[model samples]
Target: PFVPLRRITPTELATHGARKNASKIYWTVLEGRVYDITPYLPYHPGGEKELLRVAGKDGTKLFNLTHSWVNWDNMLRGCEVGILVSGNEMPG
Candidate 1:
């Protein structure tokens, strides 16, 4: 089955990112796309704490600075949670 991808707002993305380690699902935004990285935390080569630092926020800068060589698209394939809705418009 091909389920449609979800479109989330920045506010919603922030809320999910704020969950951090306290929530079952830890989310991160990169290049306007949200990904549930909870499962990859333990396996991250840099270690879980490294990823935790940017758990609930945009990690694009950090990610590029630290491991720009990494194939993020392939790495986050199935982990994608949703796409950030365009512009700053918040859902009502």
Candidate 2:
């Protein structure tokens, strides 16, 4: 599947994480890179509950706090769907 990457903002990211959303997609940010970690959910060693903490938002701080040992760049791999950018970064 060749999904196009996007420039995601905090608000848009928040929208995707809501349970009410029909998309059922989950995204998380690490080091400014946005990942559709939905595919990795079942594989997470910490279980879905812990990983959900980072859903739909920048998880850099919390991820580093717990999984500082993990190399997110390598872990996220193909899941990366975009880059996290402020709303102002979008071209008008």
Per-model tally of clashing residue pairs: 1, 0
Best by lDDT: 2
Off by over 4 Å in 1: 18-22, 86-92
Report each candidate's C-alpha RMSD, comma-separated, in the order given.
2.5, 2.9
Clash tally for model 2:
0
How high is the lDDT of residue 41 in model 2?
88
Model 1 lDDT per residue over 1-92, tens place: 99877887766666655344455677888898889998898899999888977776889999999989999889998999988786577555
Give lDDT tens digits, candidate 2, residues 1-92. Answer: 99666788888888767376678889988889999888888999999888888888889999989979998798778888888888777553
Candidate 1's TM-score: 0.81
C-alpha RMSD in Å of predicted model 1 compared with the true structure: 2.5
lDDT of each prediction vs. the true structure?
A: 0.81, 0.84
What lDDT score goes with residue 11 in model 2?
81
